[model samples]
Target chain A: AQTVTQSQPEMSVQEAETVTLSCTYDTSESNYYLFWYKQPPSRQMILVIRQEAYKQQNATENRFSVNFQKAAKSFSLKISDSQLGDTAMYFCALGGGSNYKLTFGKGTLLTVNP
Target chain B: DAGVTQSPTHLIKTRGQHVTLRCSPISGHKSVSWYQQVLGQGPQFIFQYYEKEERGRGNFPDRFSARQFPNYSSELNVNALLLGDSALYLCASSPRASSYNEQFFGPGTRLTVL
Candidate 1:
């Protein structure tokens, strides 16, 4: 079974600064996918970024990027130019090639300060 | 375009009762997945349906079940609910159940078992 872990329970960042959310996973599968999801007070889950295990290059989507270290089994999300809108509960998820289901971490509450 | 949508924005039930949650996938999506998000935790996969067939299931007990319709819409049914069952139920859809496809999520149905 694959499991994801987010050590930080809470985080805060000043507006326009950068923040990194840490994530780690345990999986035996060689082919898998890592994802970062955001949930605001509205309770909607939004995809922040995704990274494939096979890709050596990290995934970047505008201000959101991922630092994927396959050997270390770590996939961290980096949010640049943090804004008030970036405040949310961030979760790290894992999906394997054999199964389509996702395994998620407990989540980290991020508060962006103005 | 409309994102994934779930019915009954909020629900309340009691122990030994039953509950049904509905989900409408995005247009052109062929796969729908169900997840349960307990308070202060990440979402846990419950079931995944593709093309109206059961593609995958999580570690949940038999008390939970689901099915997909011809239009790719889906329903999650839970019987003999317990107070622990109170959580937010999320629906996600993808164009197909593939390693490269990223799932889109809905706002989710908040279920409260009192």
Candidate 2:
């Protein structure tokens, strides 16, 4: 069974600043994938980033990036130059292999204040 | 191309009642996945279908079932609903069944059980 854990329940950051949301996961499968998804009040789940367990390099998308430490079973998302629009509930998920199901963490509510 | 779309943005049901949510995947995408997200928590995988075949099933009970159509659109049905079943049902679509494929999500359908 795969389990994901996000220790932080809530966090805050100022606009134009940076914030990192922590995530840790334990999985039996050697080949797995990690993901960060953001859900806004609109109730839409948006993909923020994804990282493959086999890859040593972190994944990045525009202002969003991940600090993926496979050895530590950690995958944290960093949003640089945070904007008000970035405020949302962020989730960490683990999947891959033949499991076909993604396990997600409880999530962290991130607020970007002006 | 249009993203994944779901019908009936919201619904209200009672115990013993049945409900069905619909979803249309992105053009050319053949995989559809369902999730249940309770308030203040992350989404839980329910099922995954690829090319109109059941690819995976989660820990959810038999009351929760889903199927994909020839066009790759899908429907999630929950029978004998319970208050614990009240949640946001999310639909995600990807081009392939592999986890390597990026899954695009839709605005979820909020189910309220009274």
Candidate 3:
């Protein structure tokens, strides 16, 4: 079974600053996919970014990027130029080509202060 | 194109009761997955269906079941609900069963089991 861990329960960053949310997972599969999801107060789940384990190059989407270290089983999300709208519950998830289900971390609540 | 859509944005039920939640995946998407997100926690995979067939299921008991139709719409059913079952039920869909594909999510149905 794959388990994702988000060590930080909560994180705070000032507007226009940068913040990183750490994530680690336990999986035996070498080829897999990782993702970051944001859930706002409205309870809508939004996709932030995604990374393929086979690709060494990290995934970047606008202000969001991931530092994916396959050997360390660590996939961290970095939010640059943080805005108030970025404040939400962020989750890290794992899935592979053979599996359709996604295993998610406990989540980190990020607060972007103005 | 419309994103995933879920019905009964909010629902309340008592223990030992049954509840059904519906989900309509984004147009052209052929896979639908269900997840449960408890308060202050990450979403947990419940079930996944592709091509109208059961693809994967989580550790949840038989109390949780789901089905997908030809149109790609899905439904989650919970029987003998318990208080611990209270959570936000999310529906996500991808173009196919490919793990590398990104999933789009719906706003979710907040189920309160009292």
Residue pairs clashing in model 3 are: none
lDDT of 1 by residue, B1-114 (tens): 999999999999999999999999999999999999999999999999999999899999999999999988999999999999999999999999753578899999999999
List, residue by residue over A1-114, the lDDT tens digit for candidate 1: 899999999999999999999999999898998999999987688889999899999999999999999999999999999999999999999987788899999999999999
Error of 1 at B107 (Å): 0.7
C-alpha positional error of residue B83 in candidate 1 after TM-score superposition, expressed in Å:
0.8
| Candidate 2 residue lDDT tens string, B1-114 | 788899999999989999999999999999999999998889899999999999999999999999999999999999999999999999999999966666889998999999
Off by over 4 Å in 2: none
Candidate 3, residue A109: the lDDT equals: 95
Q: Pick the candidate with the highest lDDT.
A: 1
Q: After superposition, how far is residue A19 of candidate 3 from its true place, in Å?
A: 0.8
**How do the candidates rank by lDDT, highest first?**
1, 3, 2
After superposition, the stretches of candidate 3 with alpha carbons farther than 4 Å from their true spots are none
Error of 1 at A90 (Å): 0.6
Q: CA shift at A34, candidate 2, in angstroms?
A: 0.9
| Candidates ranked, most accurate by TM-score first | 1, 2, 3
Which candidate should be chosen as best, given DockQ against the real structure?
3
TM-score of chain A of 1: 0.97
- lDDT string for model 3 (B1-114, tens) is 888999999999999999999999999999999999898888899999999999988889999999999899999999999999999999999999755778889999999988
Which residue pairs collide, candidate 1? none
